[model samples]
Target chain A: MSPQDNQSTSVAASTTPTASESASARKVSRTEVRGRVWKQLPLLLGLVVLWGVLWGQFSWLNILTGFLVAIAVTRVLYLPPADISGRLNLWYSLVFIAHFIADVTVASFTVAFQALNPRPIPTSSVIAVQLRTRSDFVMTLDAIAMSLVPGSIVVEVDRERAILYFHTFDTTTAAAVEAMRAKVLVVEARIVRAIGSKDDLARIYETEATR
Target chain B: MILDSILDILTGVFLLLGGFLSVAAGVGLIRFPDAIARLHATTKPQILGLAFILLAIALQERQVSTILLLIFLLIFQMITAPVSAHMIARAGYRGGIIAPRSLLVDELEQAIDAAPEFDDTERASE
Candidate 1:
């Protein structure tokens, strides 16, 4: 008998009560694997290059250790199933990085200036920030980035209301709070466009602008 | 005297930059209107700032173990920062935080709609 037929027959024998042959015929296909691999090639290539660079200095034993470490890292940092969005363009990602770099530099100077000043830092307050992006990943990345900066922390989130309570060291007035919110929203919108579904972005624009 | 002065100056420079970045991130967190924007400000500077501080320490002490530990700490922070950010963002979404103006779409709404409803009683308790 042919290998294909033999394998099919074994698969059939494993399940008897139901019509296993027909089910097997429909279940797995070679074409599906090829399509998945085709879609994932870029991601795979990136991973391989990254791994090689990170492990380049290691000996064979050290390579093995690194491999284990990589695996552990993956397990610990396993992200939620990404909502694959057709709209995520490479250009958007580049722009997001560029904008982020600018923000970082600006913020660094702002904080340093504050530190140099002798006046007592103003009393802090939690400002409620409303978001527009619908993608969980983009929003989360933004929040994390905000929390890492100086003089502020994300204290609480009212997800239902789509509002974030941000603790600030210098909460002077409602206008100041609003200005901060606007800046964050603009960046979040850019990030969402970079990494989120086009449909998601549309909804956000529609809801936020109209409201 | 000159060499020692140079080393002291270098250390001071690193400390200043690191401290500035850390404070900037904190201020951005408080100042930025939304979580995502705040996160953008926070992650990059915090990593850069901490790296600077650690480098200064390594230079000052010039010890092998301290350097190794510093390297380990930097790696740990780099990995954890993004992962934690991802998690909190996801949780924020499941919890229902809306994006601000400028976003153009809403794929999450579809997912939330498609998701099967649990007992209303459970939701109310939350």
Candidate 2:
């Protein structure tokens, strides 16, 4: 048999391994030693650059102390793991950067407009919006983006019902609220597609009505 | 004198951008639609913007230890911000502070119940 056939045969045979061996194999595949190194490279590079800059003034002992302190802080704070898959997509970061710039610019203008206007900006109201994206990360990003837009804030999120309550400085009608909601959803969809798994995205938008 | 002037200008620009981002995050915290969203506004920019400011300070001071401490602060903020946000959101959910129409799935409630019950109320109070 060819090497491929032989490998397949070995894999098939290994599948029926006794419990202990199976557990070991399971760990091997899931741990994926190569993937971890690749995934951690960016963070490690950042650390190295930071260390190099510090090494000029600090003794070895001080450097060690600094590292220990950083690690302790990291442990206490418990930063969530970056989406490994998302980081691989170069376009994801670009899109997020673009979105952030646009959001900040528009928000600045809106805030300025409100400040310049003497009146209470007509009316303010809270509107209920249904979210299409489900991933916590995507949802969080969406909310951050919307809230940064000067006149709106996310007051509540109902994960069970997939709804959000947004307070707006100028909610005139249902249609206007809906238009804003649609804009938020569109931005979220772009972000989700750029940075999340297709399966996660689908599950996020999944509803009896939308499905 | 020219070098000093350039350094001063660079420092000023970094500080300005950092302050702008921080303000944006504050606005977002007050304006977003829900607890989950507000968490993003409160956390992400706080880390990123603060990191930039710290970096600018380090550059201005040009001290190794100061730079290291600032880096430590950045890492700490990055790690803690999300956890704090998560805790606040969970509390908001339990308290019925969240709206009913925005969520489509909730895996957290099950996880929260199944996990060991510490006095969450006391935790929140603290």
Candidate 3:
């Protein structure tokens, strides 16, 4: 089935609405169907590459099989249709990747050092930060990035208020809480620049200016 | 032959560091005072350590097929580690496993105070 058809089906399945009702609500053309599939091509390719790696083979036959398996699994899994902004700032993405690598390296060392230290363990805190972007894509990315960074992990997301709750290490004071909050916003801003739509980026800048 | 030996040595070093980090994460899990702090031990170094081990395996193995598997392992670990941690932390919070003294700011609690559905639980906690 075309990706547009897949999207309609997934959307219908996601909400309480009936399949026929959703199908009739929106008319999707053949070109639009192709476009939607093209949009999901990255996810497909990533899955196929992952499958190939998992099989530990890079041969054309293995890759072809992986590609086919990727398609089948994704189709059967019933994932929500990807909602990527489609706009990418190459420079910002490169910077973001570099920053992420550095953060991971540094944060891991810091956490490891503290964990192994004989001194009293610094108190941890659960802090809430309001996010500017409302996109689930950005929010998920932000949470994933933060969680992997060693010092903090996302505990909850209040989707309606665009507020994210994080459990952070060594956040004993109000200043420390604010610092962690600022750090999260900085990371969010980088993600916004790297992949968010123009409106999202503009909102980030506006939020930053106001703060 | 010399270059191959050098690659093997580097891979071994990476594998050692990965093992050490994994051990450190275990230590943190035991040493941490609360559920959330323990989650840091379970998530961060564990995933990074696995990545290192996967990288070492990928480097030493010449088979394209096996390398693909190693890469997949690394990616999947990275993706799932955070998600699993998130689930556990949320469950811990909702279950009241969070040490009230450790929480610096309780915005969720404040929100729950205003929420009618949470009124009884909020009062009970107080």
Candidate 1 displacement at residue A148 in angstroms? 3.3
Model 2 agreement with the true structure over A1-211: per-residue lDDT tens digits: 2322212211122123244543553365545646755665566555644664556554677567656655565446533334445433568658876876676556554554343445543344455667765465566666656655545555545544456555554545666666766767766766776776677567556742473
- Taking chain B only, the TM-score of every model is 0.75, 0.72, 0.84
lDDT of 1 by residue, B26-101 (tens): 7766765456545545665777798789889987887655666677677678547755654555455445452423
Give the TM-score of candidate 1 (chain A): 0.64
lDDT of 2 by residue, B13-118 (tens): 8788778767866776666566654554555555556766886897799866676778777666644554355456545655767563444323344344454443
- CA deviation > 4 Å runs, candidate 1: A1-47, A57-80, A158-161, A207-211, B1-46, B51-126
Best by lDDT: 3
lDDT of 3 by residue, A1-211 (tens): 3323222211122223346755653688889768778887998888877766666556899888988888898677645465688899999999998998789878887887788987887887777888999676787788889988998987767655678888889887889889999999999999999999888999999987887
DockQ, per-model, please?
0.11, 0.12, 0.46
lDDT of 1 by residue, A79-161 (tens): 32233454567898999878776775566566555544556444444455678655545655666556554444554444444
Write down the lDDT of every candidate, Cα atoms only: 0.57, 0.56, 0.79
How close to the true structure is residue B111 of candidate 1, measured as C-alpha lDDT? 32
Name the weakest run of 10 consecutive residues (lDDT summed) in model 3 chain A.
Answer: A6-15
Residue range with the least summed lDDT across 10 consecutive positions in model 1 chain A: A6-15
Top candidate on DockQ is 3
Q: Give the least accurate 10-residue stretch of model 2 chain B, judged by summed lDDT.
A: B117-126
Ordering by DockQ:
3, 2, 1
Question: Ranking under TM-score, best-scoring first?
Answer: 3, 1, 2
